[model samples]
Target: MCKKKPYLLSSIREGARLGIQECRNQFKHERWNCSILPSIYTSSSSLSLSVLSSALASAHSIFGYELTSGTKETAFISAVTAAGLVHSVTRSCSAGNMTECSCDTSLQNGGSPSEGWHWGGCSDELQYGMWFSRKFLDAPYKNSSDSDVLSAMHLHNNEAGRLAVAKLMTVDCRCHGVSGSCAVKTCWKSMSSFEKIGSYLKDKYENSIQISDKLKGKVRRKEKNHRKIPIKKEDLVYTNRSPNYCVEDRKLGISGTHGRECNRTSDGPDGCNLLCCGRGYNTHVVRHVERCECKFVWCCYVRCRRCESMTDVHTCK
Candidate 1:
């Protein structure tokens, strides 16, 4: 596929970048923070095609290790990256960047006339995106047996991620009439912003299901009472509980919360008490300097005065 559709290389790189960045953003306040070890890649060179390919391969290796761990964090990474790939590829299709796909025309000229609206514009081509993402990302686990717990969990989470993109797809419409009067509306389906997708996956991660490690011809929740509850396509699944990220574990690649900045006032995950894992925290006085009190000038320029302030910063001990 890479040789046949060389243009897709850029989209793949963009998709991986989007996924990793969004993962970090969603977990910024958490202990894990979705960080990749510096040793994973040797060089931080610019994103040439070869470099990008290497990066993607390295990411896959990392994800593979996480999959073996079978933790909730691993579930989130699988889902978010899968959704990101679908989003980027779909956007490319909508933009006519690929010869094989363009905006979805299936809904074109199809709508309820009684509602004074009809589908007429270029709806995002999510079908192609979903197909491609599955083919590329899920291809590795395709040969694994159903009883292989790690592969099953990974495949399920990957589909859940793709479903998230489809679940959040929205409709955008344009008014068509004289003087913008109430007459007809042209609507098209579009995917939500990547941020929204990331947020949704984060929520899913919070409520992710833990399946039994043994696969008896199908995946089931670990709890006996919930075994009958059918796993939905949108639900994230994992086989193992996550390790507490309070202390660094080089073997697991966790950086822990030591020296991590924390919110003194907040009671959330970012709060000093919780984030520090009851180990306590340290406070330091830091100075900040920036341009302040800016005013617009007549010559299309602005002037500002330099400002300096001292503040106390808190970090986990």
Candidate 2:
């Protein structure tokens, strides 16, 4: 695919970046925080070096050892990235950048006349995007042995991510006929924003289920009593429990919460008491300056006065 459609390389990179950034944003208040580690690779060809220097600089940054640890975080990463790829590829298709695909025309000239609306504009072509994402991301696990629990978990989460994109698709309509009267409407299907997809995946992560590491004919809950419960395609799954993430562990690449900023008030995950893991926190007064009290001038410019304020900031001890 890369050899045939080189233009998609940019979209693929964008998708990866989108996924990693969303992962970090969703976990910002958590102990893990989705921190990345630089990857090392060797290539003898100059072209590979050029590609590495420019487009693929941070390609492997998100593949921390934890990704293979079979934790919930890993599930979230897999799902988000898979969704991101579908999003970017669909966008590229809509923008007319790709030769193999374009906006979906299946619904054209199809709608109920009684409802006074028709499917006319370019509905996003999600099918092609979904197909491509699956082929590209799932190829590695296709031949994996049945005992590869981590591979199975990743494959399931990848589908969950793609499913999220499909589930959140919405219909947009434009009114026509004499200054936008309620006479006619053209509706088209559109994808939800990537932020929404990330939020959905985060919710799934919070409720992620732990599956038995030992693969029997199919995946089951780690707990024997709940093994009868059926796992849904949309649910995120993991095989291993995560580290406490309160103290630094170099071996696992967990930075822990030391010196991390925390909210002095509130009882959420960001609260000092919880984020600090009972080690306590330190308070500091920090000064902030920014533009304020702006006014438009007669010309094409505006003027503003600088404002300064001192606020208390807290960090985990």
Candidate 3:
């Protein structure tokens, strides 16, 4: 077998440089989104992802019972697929300009000493991939113009799209190495994610959400609960499994789905990200919070678009 030193590869070297650039960029942007942790919002390294493919090229490497790049990549991908970014992994959707790069999504051998390597265990990989995806997703890159960021912000709704962006953003890093390579290391995913109230969130979702509506709703949120748990002005959070957003708002619920009632605020303009949620539709509000938007008559849970402008229903005529 031909033995080569790790630094011999030119492509890897260039990737390392790019990774450094990304790290520097992330350092700069996190200043504005001060509350958003770079680690939780970003992926670790593209160089690692590339190295994974090379390691997978040979089956012998898998049997070596050592930590190979492919095994690391595979295990991490599997964990993320199952527990982290399940949305993107399950759909197998490709981004608009994706260059056909693909990854293996299997991790049955993750926990075994005989089969392959371990990043501790299933939950660990899930957490690792969760953090990995986040770092890339939120990492600031010069690859695309700021306009792309604004445009991609809309893509936040699509789990696969976010994953693709993450993958692409880390391409240079993967080519390089993990030594200070494109690592922003935000503590976003490091902390335990808060619970997701799936059904509870849907019940509170407001429809036809405009920028103005967002402004008004936040104001309403502040006014309605002056004495309650104060969500700091800058803190945000997102789900660990698929569709990550906010990064600081740790407690989460599935996005864009209607479900049984609980008094949780919708996380986005479209609603869905809830601080607390429940089982199914026909949602009933919880006892602790002022339940609104129940199947019952008047629901403050579901807000109305026209009504926000209306003083009286009879006066509309």
Candidate 4:
């Protein structure tokens, strides 16, 4: 069995789960929905609902191992993993659960002493979290030279993920005063919500860079006219083309749109027309009972009445 890292296994598991949840939350309305992870495999016997051509099966198998290298998938994974790492580390540190690290001391205060403000709160140690993330995540790919397109792509995407966190760091401040007088202010740098980071990374994934081949240990753009343009360290890079997820195919590891919930009024990819791959969908009525007419109680609790509602639910055929 392989030995674990310096970190606790529970922390690692929590971090991974948080990251995956962030990805799902960001992609909840998108076509891919970040379900490509954990490996969506369909066997020939299990795919009786949709017959798979032999050629398609072979193509599917090729893509099974290639998920880690896929451009969009790689971008999502990297961003989510980075976000989760920071979230887990910072929270753990703040809760006094982490023994190795605590609040940040390196973060600088913007307002001068003569001005009005200074950094004073227990700032989240993003640098330590980022350093730990880089060391832990990049360990497997460290020995790989830049010439290896796959490793190069993963590293670049991973860095992009970490950068997303760094780019979205926000400043939170509190006012200190006597009575109504404003005297001084204390501020600390904090991370933006994971949702925001995930959304930002999703945009990056949509606009990710496509590289054809490596030249002299460097990734070059696929377009000949853009070959001279060096890839940015902040941008995500992918070497392989993504497969169409419209249909279910075990070989390609695609979970087709059949039976997937869709919006009837939507014209986007999540709409029934696009999501069902033009195969059509079935509509069914769903009844929901939710708490309604909520009122605050004397102490603090809320009292509510049950209300019934009904709506049409559409599923791809």
What RMSD, rounded to one decimal, does every model reach? 2.3, 4.2, 23.7, 7.6
How accurate locally, in lDDT, is each candidate? 0.85, 0.83, 0.25, 0.69
Q: Return the top candidate by lDDT.
A: 1
Clashing pairs in 1: none
lDDT of 4: 0.69
Q: Comparing 3 and 4 by lDDT, which wins?
A: 4
Candidate 4: Cα lDDT at 38: 38
Estimate TM-scores for all models. Answer: 0.92, 0.89, 0.18, 0.81
> For candidate 1, lDDT tens digit of each residue in 256-309?
899999999999999999999999999999999999999999999999999999
Residue 191 lDDT in candidate 1: 96
- By lDDT: ranked, best first: 1, 2, 4, 3
Once superposed on the true structure, which residue ranges of model 1 sit more than 4 Å away at CA? 40-51, 54-58, 62-65, 145-147, 296-303
- Model 4, span 120-232: residue lDDT tens: 88777777677766776766667655447776676677788888888888989888889855588888878888888888887888888888755456777888898888887
User: Any idea what lDDT model 3 has?
Assistant: 0.25
Q: How much is the lDDT of residue 22 in candidate 4? A: 74
Query: TM-score of the candidate numbered 1?
Result: 0.92
Q: Could you give candidate 2's per-residue lDDT for residues 1-317 as a string of tens digits?
A: 66766777887777776777788899899888887764333354222333322222223344566778899988988898899889989989988888889999989989976999999888998988898888878876776665498888988999999999999999999888897696989999999999999999999999999998888776778999987889999999999888889998878888889999999896999999999999999999999999999999999899999999999999998
> Which stretch of 10 consecutive residues in model 1 shows the poorest summed lDDT?
49-58
Candidate with best TM-score: 1
How close to the true structure is residue 161 of candidate 2, measured as C-alpha lDDT?
97
